[model samples]
Target: MSKVFAKRLFDGESWLTNQQVTLSGNVIESIMTVEVPSADAQSVDVLAPGFIDVHVNGGGGALFNHTPTLAALQRMVEVHAQYGTVAMMPTLISDDYEIMSQAHQTVCQALTENMGGILGLHYEGPYLNPVRKGVHNESKLRKPTEGKLADLLDVCRLSKLMVTLAPEQVPEDFIEWLTAEGAIVCIGHSAATYDQARQAVESGAKGFTHLFNAMTPLVSREPGVVGAALQTDKPTWCGLIADGHHVHPATMRVAIAAKGCEHMLLVTDAIQSVGSDEKEMAFLGKKVLRSNGRVTTEDGTLAGSDLDMATAVRNTVSLIGRTEAEALQMASLRPAEFLGIDKEFGRIKVGYRGSLVALTDDFFVEATWIDGQKVWG
Candidate 1:
């Protein structure tokens, strides 16, 4: 058993002052108010549930698409943990069948080995519309074949699988079939009309990837995919980048106003540049550069991002005018709830996992603990 005392604690739902949280093995055992923290109780200025990222391409100079190995997974996890991310879904942007299969196998092996901080795999494309396939190799994009669909379903059965696709590019029943087999379907990189987007949601798409980027906008008459995402009342979650570049502050404000804090979440959509000193990298035969906190291709297409989860929370608070609690919830509980692991992973309650992050007053990461074991400081 171990204990951590926090001067300020956000226990997933509300804030409390001067509390001690106890842990046994990997689960939180108890929490109580404390006037004087014990000498042995590891203390922190701020404690909250660890940030959970549902979309991450790479970090620590290890691009999952470039390596797709266990070593790469370890590196990504190590770097993100420093930024307060205790768990993440390593995302593979639109790749060929062979690469996708390799990524799936790699994640399965990681899970079997009980690799810390790996939730599952996020297959971000290959079944996307080329018209809006931001930074994705158009040549790699294709309609889903029967064999490919079956293989993807196998991935779902093995672990938590999130498949992002364009609604118009796949069959009408594709989302339903994938969801039936336990895959989390998300709409992204699509130019689907509002009706098409709504149909995809009704069919089983649970979330929208990187809302307002790489998607049809909410026009006055068309009310495209963006409109569908905003107007839907079907428990669907929308992931905002919150980096001040992928989306405008005013636009993010409007999205929050429309979707409510409960149904909105923050995702870094981060790439290899994050947590690394490298300023340039090659992506799908294109030269990618990181400048001023943004990653863009040579032709000026926004690739991924240089943002991290901690900075995302800060941006949400400072740029979007949200409270610290609201920003933390968007970074933690909302993503956990979207991934269907809220009960175990997103809170500091008695029965929840002892995965938490300690932050400074400005929301910078001071330390991180996963399963009650300190991983970064």
Candidate 2:
């Protein structure tokens, strides 16, 4: 049976009305907006593709570092599902070697259960620049060695593994090695020079972890990784945390002024504290206090954010001077393309999965559908 949604549809290119939709099991069977419903109609505010969050460490107060349990994954899933994020990746930051292995294995198993839209996993680090470690455990960060890379890739195995590392930290000889292994290599938490970053970009690095944080700053003389990332030729997509703190509404206007939205991706980089009223939460084996909505550690180092997929979408549109559809693409379409999963998840089409979000005028998620099922509304 297919579910009909009220209002407009993203349609991948533009929003249109007079639509009718049909779902068969876990996929959208048909979408006919101009026709009348045949008896069973499930109308909603506005139907858009389900948001794809690539960097989610924790949710519902369960930190991935604290416990990457199936129950914790469920909590994270439920929290974001309410916010219209039907698909997400469980992210883990720099931690002990055992913890890292456990986290990776846990995500692989979770994907087996296929809770709603758990597409894959994002391992933020084990290899990173200690000087730019942000809130990650600095002591656990290490230079990428041949033996370690082998073991790590084996752990990633058949799961979608997105690794954020400093190109400078990893041996230059291994650039092609990681790329050849089908790893979604993202440059982040690095202080690499422009040339170093450019070389990695050419080697098949597709994106950045979180733009403008814990990474090299763009300079006139050096140009840094930011400049290389925003480079037009063989450029890398920048994952931006648009929580208004991690990045200001105005900076995005300037940052993407020339590069455009296609060069940028919206990542919440959300931590365990999301969906909570408590002022602070635990991070990096310490209690990170949040005052004035800024999440930071006791040492004053900035930590992961508290925003969800829905908040990021709304903020990108309402605050960042982008249309709702435009912001929504950054959350879903653009990210899917960045991960090379666009054909299946980003757009609303005949063969694509029927994961979608229905939002009100204010951009808040009103209803969410995962694989043709009404999971939240």
Candidate 3:
């Protein structure tokens, strides 16, 4: 067993001070108020549940699409861990069947090895709509076939799979079928109408990817995908890229107000430039550049992002005017709930996993722990 002393701690739901958290193996063993600081306890300024990123394309100079290998995935985990991301779903943008199969096999191997910080695979799609294929290769976009669907089902069987597609572009029963097979279906990169979005949710689409960007906007007359995401009464999650480039602060504020913070989570939608010194990288045979906190193609198409989870949590506070605890929850707890791993990974309770992060006063990550083992500092 191990013990760490937290000067201030956010235990998922509320904040507490001067607490000692004990861990046994990979799980939190106990937590108690510390009337007096123990000299043996490892001290931290601020500790909270580790951030869970559902959408990550690359980091540490590795792009999952470019190099669908175990080494590349490990590099990503190392880079994001410095930013307090204890778990992530490595995302592959629209790609061919061969590359998709390769990526899937790589993730399976990682899972089999019990690699730290690798939660699953997020196939962000070959099944997306071509119209809103931002940075995704248009040539790779296609309708899902029986063979592809079968492969995806196998992926769900092996690990947690999150598939993103356009509701209107897919068959009426595609979302239902995938969800039934244990895949978390999400809507993105489409011009689906409000009704279409609603129907997709009713049919088992659990979330919206990158909430506003690459999706139909909310208009006065016709509520588009954004409208449906905000107005849906079901327990659906919406991923907001709090990077400031993908969404305006005011717009994000309104969306959070409408959807409520419990249903609103943050995603980086990050690419290779994140957590690396590289200012330029290749994306689907095209050159992409990172500058002034934004990553974009030469033609001014917004690619993914250079954002990290720590900065995302910081932005939720500074940009969106949310409390620090709320911002931390969006980064950790809410995403865990969205992925249906909340009971084990989202909190600092005694029975939960000992995945946690400590941050400085500026919200920069000081240390990160995944399953009771310190991974970064």
Candidate 4:
């Protein structure tokens, strides 16, 4: 068994002290919180579950929009690993049907070769409200036609397909249909009214993608998509970008108050610009202007985020008024649970996968492991 020891550890719920965890292959075989490190253990600091980012556009100067080759996948995965992101769903923005199809094939190929970190494909566009589409090219937005989506996922042979659609545009029945096919339907890039958004949720829209940004706002009479997403009784996981830019600090508080931390998943929603020190770059077929850790266009619409998974953890904690343990949950265990992957990925408990990250006191991931294998930088 391979073992890791940490001075502090997050056990998926709360912070604990003096953790010594042993793993064999992918599963954690044993866990003990004791004073001394195990004889067979490699010691680290603040060991936590490896982060699971449900939305990542690109990293390491490569983007899914530009070219989604397997090599590009490897690059992003490596860069994200440095920040403790272990498993991630490669996100592709709204694009032509042909480009999306190729992305699906890319996911299938990644899966076939045991590219373990590639969870699935996230289609963030093509069925969205053009009125609320942010960086998504409005020209490529399409109405949901009968069987078009199923055909796309099938062609790509994708097991998990997360689609973010504007409830204002797509029919309610499509939400039911997509959910029935095991495709996670998320509401995002939308101008969906309250009733429309609620109907989508009722029809099996399980999540809200990058909530509060590019979505309808809460109103007195209208309530809007943001309002619908904040309803706690609803079983939807509200995905937050948490960059301190996409949603304001006060608004972030409201989201946390409305939806409990468990009901929220933190995602970078990062485009190709994340993790790159490169000053000049082109993204989404246009120039990306970056200054002081902010990535945006000259017009000031957020292109994506320079914030990686680790920084996301820090930023979320600052906004939520919660402990580091709680914020980390949004980045790790909670997201894994939202994806129904908690059994294997979210914790350092027995029988769980050894997807762990060692973070500094400031929450920077120093090293990452997927299963028991180190994802070296």
Candidate 5:
């Protein structure tokens, strides 16, 4: 068992001060407020539930599409750990079947080995709409065939799966099939109308890949995918790239105001340049440049991002005018809830995993712990 003492602890819902959290093995055992700190407790300024990112393309000077190996995945995990990401879905962009198969195998291998910070996989797709492909390979974009769907479903048994697809590209019951298979279905890279997007959510699509990017825009007469995202009474969550480049601060404020912070999630959408000081990296045979806190191609096409999870949480407070607790919730609790792993993964409550991060007063990550063991500092 282990004990952690933080000046403040964000226990998934709200902040508690001067508390001691006990952990046994990988799960939290108990938490209690203390007037005098425990003698053996590890102390920190602020402790929070480790960030759970659902839309990570690449990091640590390695792009998953390029390497698709366990070593590459481990490097991504170690690099992102420094930024306080305890768990992530190593996302693969639109690629051929062979590469996708390799990625699936690699994630399975990581899970089999019980690798820390490897939480299944995310395929951001070969089944996306070509019109809004963004940095994805348009040549690889295609509808899901029965064989391909079966192959993907097979991999879901090895680990959790989050598949991002265009509602317009796949068959009528595609989203339902994915949901039934226990994979989280996210709608993205589409040009779907509002009704179509809403229907997909009604059909079991639980989230949007990255809101307000590469998807259809909201028009006064015709409410598009963005409109469906902003609507109420639907349980769909929208993942927002909070790097301040993919979205304007004013626009992010509007989204939080409309949908409320409960439905808004913070995602890095980070690419290879995130961990290293490199200014350039290759993506799908195209050169990507990192500048002014954004990554873009020569023609000014936004590839992914240089943002990290800790930075995204900080931006949520500074740029979006939200509380630190709310910002932390978007990065951790909400994403876990969206993935249906909240009961075990998203809190400092009893029985939850002892995955947590310590941040300084300015929100910089001071250290990180996964399963009660320190991983990065």
Candidate 6:
């Protein structure tokens, strides 16, 4: 058994000081609060649930969409681990069928090996709308047919799968089928009206991907995808890039007010430059440069991002004026809930996995532990 104490502990919902957490193997054994701090407890300024990222395309100078290999996946996990990301759904963006098949096999191998930090795989496109495609390759985009959907579903039974598509391009029943098969269907890259987006929600589309960008803007009358996202009464979730470039501070505040932290998530949408010193990388056969804290192609098309999860949590606290506890939830618990894996991964409570992050008072990641093993500092 191991024990850790924190000056302040955010126990999923609220903060408490002078708390000790006991762990056995890879699971938390118990949590206790002490009036006086323990002198020998391994302690830090703040103890938080490890960050969970659902939209990471790449890290450690590697892009999953470019090279779908076990080595690439390990490098990406190691890179993000330094930023307090203990679990992530490595994302593969729009690509050809051959690439997608290769990625599926690679993800299966990684999961079979019980590789640390590889939660699942997020297939972000190929079923997207061309109108709001953003950086996704238009040539590879297509509507989902039964055959294509079956091929994709075949991978989900082996691991958790999240497929982001355009609601306007897919049939309602297909969304239902995907969800029934244990795939989280997310809406993105579309020009769907409010009604179409709402229909998707009713049809089992559980979340919105990279919420304002690449989605139809919410207008006063039209009320596009953004409107549907903000106004949905269901326990629907929306992921924000939160790099301060994809969204403004004021707009992020508005989103928080409307959806609140429970229905919202913070995603990195990170590209290949996260842990590398490289100033540029390739995406979809185009070169993307990182400058001014933004990643964009030569034509100024916003690609993924250069942001990491730890920096994203800091931006959420400072840029949107949210409390540290709330920001940490946005990075960890909320995303875990959205992925329907909170029971196993998100909280620091008894029986939860010992995937935890220790942060400085200033929000810098001092250290990260995954499954009771210290992986990064």
Q: Compute the lDDT of residue 159 as modeled in candidate 5.
A: 64
Model 4, span 1-377: residue lDDT tens: 67888899888877888888887887788889788786877788789989999999999889897897898899889888888899999999998877887888888888877786888888998888889988777788989776656667652344567888887787757888877777888999888789888999888888998888888899889899989999987788988887777788788887787788888888998766777778768877778888877788778778877878888888877765777877888988888877778888788789888888988888777778887788752
| Per-prediction backbone clash count | 0, 7, 0, 0, 0, 0
Model 5 C-alpha lDDT per residue in residues 320-363, reported as the tens digit of each score: 99999899999999988887789877788988998999999889
TM-score of each: 0.98, 0.95, 0.98, 0.96, 0.97, 0.96
Candidate 1 residue-wise lDDT, 206-305, digit = tens: 8999999999999889999999998747999999998999999999999999989988988998998988888888877788999999999988899988
Global lDDT of each candidate = 0.91, 0.81, 0.90, 0.83, 0.89, 0.88
For model 3, what is the error of residue 324's alpha carbon versus the real structure, in angstroms, after optimal superposition?
0.8
Candidate 2 — worst ten consecutive residues by lDDT sum? 148-157
After superposition, the stretches of candidate 6 with alpha carbons farther than 4 Å from their true spots are: 34-41
lDDT of 5 at 18: 94
- Per-residue lDDT for 171-228 in model 3, tens only? 8888888888899999999889999999998999988999998988999998999998
Q: State model 5's lDDT.
A: 0.89
What overall lDDT, based on C-alpha atoms, would model 4 receive against the true structure? 0.83
State residue 338's C-alpha deviation in candidate 4, in Å.
1.4
Candidate number achieving the greatest lDDT relative to the actual structure: 1
Q: Of models 1 and 4, which has the larger lDDT?
A: 1
